[model samples]
Target: MQYEFRPSGVCSSKIVLDVEGDIVRKVQFVGGCSGNSQGIGALVQGMKVDDVIGRLRGIRCGRRNTSCPDQLAQALLLYQSKNETKE
Candidate 1:
């Protein structure tokens, strides 16, 4: 499955991730700290959704209390919940 997150309170315009079963295949962030986003994407590329959420959910951008990464985690959770309910 492919997931796209449009998060608030961050430099990135959008986040895109591709998942197969429990593993992430590709992650791309648009309009952020280019290098950092790329590195993050690469690092999380093969990780499971739960693992990614665990690692990223609490990350905050300074005092704003939510970063792009955190928002991505939320989005993934929401998406998973919605999909599961359809089954």
Candidate 2:
């Protein structure tokens, strides 16, 4: 399934990704550092959502306490939870 998240406290305004079973793919971020966001997207593509969360959840943007990557992980977790609840 495809999920789009509008995240808070991040440089990116939104993130869109495709998830199938445990795999996350085609991650795209809007309104952020274009190259970095796309690089992140490519790196996480085909990775498990849980794995992505584990690796990225605690990352901070310098002293701000949260980074765009961390927010993406949160968004994936939120999406997964909502999907599970629906099923």
Residue range 1-87, candidate 1, lDDT tens digits: 888888788899898878777678898899978998888888888888899999999799889888878877887787788778878
TM-score versus the correct structure, for each prediction:
0.89, 0.94
Model 2 scores a TM of 0.94
Check candidate 2 and list the clashing pairs.
none
For each candidate, how many residue pairs have backbone atoms clashing (under 3 Å)? Answer: 0, 0
Best by TM-score: 2
User: What TM-score would you give candidate 1 relative to the actual structure?
Assistant: 0.89
Per-residue lDDT, model 1, residue 5, is 81
